[model samples]
Target: MERLLAPVKAFLHGETPSSWIEEARRPERLAVVLQDHLLCELKAAQTAVWLLRRYALDKGGSERLKGWLRPFEDRVYRPCLVKEHQAMASEVTPAGLSCRPDAPLAGPLVEKMVRLIKEELHHFEQVRTLMLARGIVIEPIRASRYAASLMQLVRSGDPWVLVDRLIIGAYIEARSCERFAALAPHMDEEVQRFYVSLLRSEARHYQDYLALAQMASPEPIDARVREIGEAEWRLIAEPDALFRFHSGVPSAL
Candidate 1:
């Protein structure tokens, strides 16, 4: 586990605040934590698909990708069929959408992002299955400012904007990896095993984002990475009223 997290630890400016971990450990907070986690997984997959459509895939490829995600999206957007959605989650697989021939970075981007989307959706299913087993309802919860704030740092223009977004993706994945490791020990055996199980893929997702950022950039991304990492650190270090998977330190704590 430590081996998997070494790069994640090195990449981030800070660890999840001990206060946030403490707040998450409370039994009452489990449902909300898992709920937010499931949502985050969907969001992660959605972001990867967006990247593929914008920079890698053709129109046909993009639409095909969307079809692949429909059942999962339905689970959230069309909540009337909650039981149906839960059953459909495990069946999601990669759509193998081809990339645009001329986009220089399309091949790697498509390959990495597709795998990322697949894993993330699988994670969504896993978390949702756990929630169902525990009788945890998927209630509506507000999003944290963490991702929106980081995205605000993305600069304007084509490749630079793409690179910046990829860098932000790295930080988000890295932070998630760190938090999973930090929270694992405090959770019940099943939850702990699950969190620990996620470390490898989450850590690789972080690396994939970084690699894509570097590939997209004309120059080195170290400066931009540090700049964005600093902003992500501030977001985590600040006090937040809403408790979420990626929220800052809990204000109530």
Candidate 2:
């Protein structure tokens, strides 16, 4: 944990605010925390699929990937589709991930992202199961501005575009890892254990994204990283109207 924290701590510009942690740990807010956590897991996998579709896969591969994700989206968006797609939840298989021969860094990108997609889907299922056991229903909420705000800071065009996306991915994963570690002690036993279990992969996801960004870029990324890290810090440190899992400090505080 010490070794992992060194890079992640340096990578992000700020810690999860004390006020947000207080809000997250409140008994009345557990449902909101779990609900947003569950949806973020889904969004992470969907983003992985999108990356593969745009940068790695060919036309046919992209279509097939979309077909594969339809059921998951259906289940997520509509409560009625949950039972129908429940069986498919446990069936995430990266058995047939195909990448374009001409795609840059094809093998590494596909391998890392496919694994990420599978793990994220599995995590999604776990969260949903826990929700069901607690009689909590999955409801859609407006997304927190954190991710889109990070994306806005990414530079426009070419290798920089790709590098910026990768860097942003790293920041997101790092923040999630940090937040999980921060929140664990305050949660119920099951939730605490789940968050603890998540730290390892979440840390790795940040590393993989950064490594991929370096591979994809021809120039140094240190300055860009620091610049974006500051943006991430501001996003987390600011007051917010909504209090989703990844949201900033609660306004009521």
Candidate 3:
């Protein structure tokens, strides 16, 4: 815990305002935050699935990948497709995942990615359970601009391909961790507890993604990480049109 606190303390000192914590702890804000939180988990799972399919797997493997997510996508992921009062009670399990020749990936990369997918899916379920308990209806909202903006910077082809994707993943995980820390203190006890519990996992996920990026690429990752980190910091600090979990400082919406 001390090791975790070292970085988080530095992060909080540098990026978060003191008053923000007070504002975040209010019980009145939990519903809105939780709604965003739930959506964020879905998006995380979706992002991991997309990355694995695009970079690590072959066509047949990708189809199998999509199959793993199809049930959730059909039921819980796209909220607009289902009745407001109705929720899917069954859970989908991903099975028989293995590397393919057309896009052979390293074992460690595959293992880490598959584990992340499972964790993200589990988190999606947890968020759904919280929403059900709180009577927070799941609705499709327009995605925040954070991801699209970062993706626009991805260089086309080969080495850049892996580097850019991994950089984006790091940014996403970092931002999610930042927001969880930012919002947790101001939330109701239940929500605060949940968000606080999430801090360690999210922090580790960011590191894991960054480490994988470094391992996959021959180029030095530090400079790339620094460059992307600066860009991410701008996205977070600047005014924005939306207020999804990863969105920048809320504009007048």
Candidate 4:
């Protein structure tokens, strides 16, 4: 476990301070943070779905992919679920649709992506449960700039495109894990424990995304990973225009 989590520890504890966690645990702040947390988890799951559907799955499979997200989408965004709890509530068990991985592309990419999708979905459910326990009302908010900024670095070609996307994925997972660790110290016992527990799985998700990126391209992925890593650091460290979960230091709204 130590070996598996070494990178995660280094990333989280290196620059992040102990005080941030202290602030995040306040009950007064819990509702706002939980709202952001809920959206972030859903976005993470959405991102995985987009990746697999765009790169690995066929057209027919991709349509099914949209169907898989329909339940949550309908309830939260579409207003079609009817029941009050179902309409405005989030699920405690993150939901996901199974993919048909037998066709077209077959490799570790498929395996890793599918596993990632499952984990992300589970994280979504966990966050939703936390929100429910706290009575944090669910509402839609615009996305943070973190993802868009990272994606701007993607190259304009096949292998490079895929490689860049994977590197971005690595950074996203790594940053999420890092933030969780940073914020855990300030959190209440329950939230703190949850964040700590997420470190291992989140660490694996980062590595898995990087490994897949390397597999997809013939070029060495290190330099590109480093480039993207620097970009990610800036995104986290610099001032931002939004306060969504992955947004940089909170800016004045």
Candidate 5:
């Protein structure tokens, strides 16, 4: 546990608040937390797809991504049977998706984004299965302010916009990794194992986003990274009314 804390501590600007964990550990709240986590994984994949389509891929690539998500989107757009979601999730694979060689940062961006989407979707499937086993209905909740607030800092330009997005992605991933590590010990056996299992991929996702940011940027992004990191810290450390998976301390509490 001490060893795990090292990387998680360095990854985020601030720790997951103790108040947040206290609330998260309650049995009454577990379902909501897990459901939010399950969908948050999908949201991460959507963000990756958006980045790929917006900056890394051509029209064909974008269309292929749509096809890839068609199955899971149906599950979220409207309530579907659990078996239907399972079957559709089972069919998600990156076999047919390939990067076009003609775009900016095409190779690294496509490669990493594709891998991220694959893993994130896989995680979504895993979480859904866990939810099913626990008799929790998979419901689509509205997104929290965590991601949107971070994205508000994104500038308006070509590579500049992409650079900021990538930086934001890094912060998001890093915070996810930190949260998993921080909350793992407080979770039940099944949930704890699941959270711990996610640490490696989340850690890699942060690094991949940072690497992509550097690749997309004209110059060094250390200063920009620090700037975004601080913003992320504020979001984590401050009070929030909504208590989704990545939210800060609950205001009402």
Candidate 6:
């Protein structure tokens, strides 16, 4: 665990504040946290799909990915179909993920992201199962500003755009891993074990994102990383109106 978190801690700009952890462990907040976390897993998988569609995959590959993701997507967007979607959780095999012949770094990108999507969807099912066992029904919750605010930094060109998105991805994954570590000890036994279990894959996801960003960039990305790191830090270290898995410090804490 130390080996996994050492780089994650170094890569991230700020740690999740103690106050947010305190607020999150409250009984009233568990449902909210798990709900948002469930959605976050879905969003993470969706982001990977977006990357494959835009940068790695051919039309057939993208469609196959979309079909695999539809049930998960519907589970979030259509809360009434929760039980229906639960049955399809094990059906996320996105076979035939063919990439474009001319797409640079397509092979590594496809391999890494395909693995990431599978893990994230699996995590989604795990969280959902926990919620069900606790009698927590899936409900709609507004997204926190953390991710959307970071994405505003993405540039509007080919390599620059991809580079910026990948850097942002690294930050998101790093933050998730860091928070999981921070929250584990405070959670109940079941939740703590689950959060701890996520640390390895989440850590790797951040590293994979950073490596991809660096590879896709035409030059050193230190400056760009520092720039985005600062933004991510502000989002974490500042006061936030809402409580979420990735939200900033809670004002009400």
Q: How do these models rank on TM-score, best leading?
A: 6, 1, 2, 5, 3, 4
Encode model 3's per-residue lDDT on 169-248: one tens digit a residue. 87787667776776765666777787777778788777778888887788788777777777877777777766556666
lDDT of 5 by residue, 3-34 (tens): 65566568678888999989889899998998
Model 5, residue 228: distance off in Å is 0.7
Sorted on lDDT, best first, the list reads: 6, 1, 2, 5, 4, 3
Tell me the whole-model lDDT of each prediction, alpha carbons only.
Answer: 0.88, 0.84, 0.67, 0.69, 0.83, 0.89
Which consecutive 10 residues in model 4 have the weakest lDDT in total?
87-96
Clashes of 4: 2
lDDT of 2 by residue, 1-253 (tens): 6677777887888889999999999999998888889889888888888888878988877877777667667667866765554445345555576778889877788889878877887788789889989998788778889998888876777788889999999999999999999899999999999988888899999999999989989988898888888888888998988888888988964
Mark the regions of model 1 whose C-alpha exceeds 4 Å error after superposition: 81-96
TM-score of each: 0.94, 0.93, 0.83, 0.82, 0.92, 0.95
lDDT of 6 by residue, 1-253 (tens): 8888999989887788898999999989999999999999999999999999999889989998897787787777876665553445456554667889889978878888888988998998899889999998787689999999999999998899999999999999999999999999999999999999999999999999999999999999999999999999999999998889999989964
Residue 111's C-alpha lDDT in candidate 5?
79
Alpha-carbon deviation at 66 in model 1, angstroms: 0.4
lDDT of 4 by residue, 31-145 (tens): 7777777777667768877877767666665776666566565544754463544422223212333345553333465577666666666666678778778777777767789
Instruction: Count residue pairs with overlapping backbones in model 1.
Output: 0
Candidate 1 lDDT over 1-253, as tens digits, reads 7888877888898888899998999999998999999889999999998898999888888998887787787777787755563444344444557678878888888879888888998898899789989999875578889999998898999898899999999999999999999999999999999999999999999999999999999999898899999999999999998899999989964
Question: Candidate 2: misplaced stretches above 4 Å?
Answer: 83-95
> Which residue ranges in model 4 land beyond 4 Å of their true spot?
1-5, 9-14, 17-26, 79-105, 251-253
Model 6's TM-score against the true structure: 0.95
Model 6: CA > 4 A from native: 79-95
Pitting candidate 1 against candidate 4, the one with the higher TM-score is 1
Assess candidate 2 and give its TM-score to the true structure.
Answer: 0.93
Where is model 5 poorest over a 10-residue stretch in terms of lDDT? 81-90
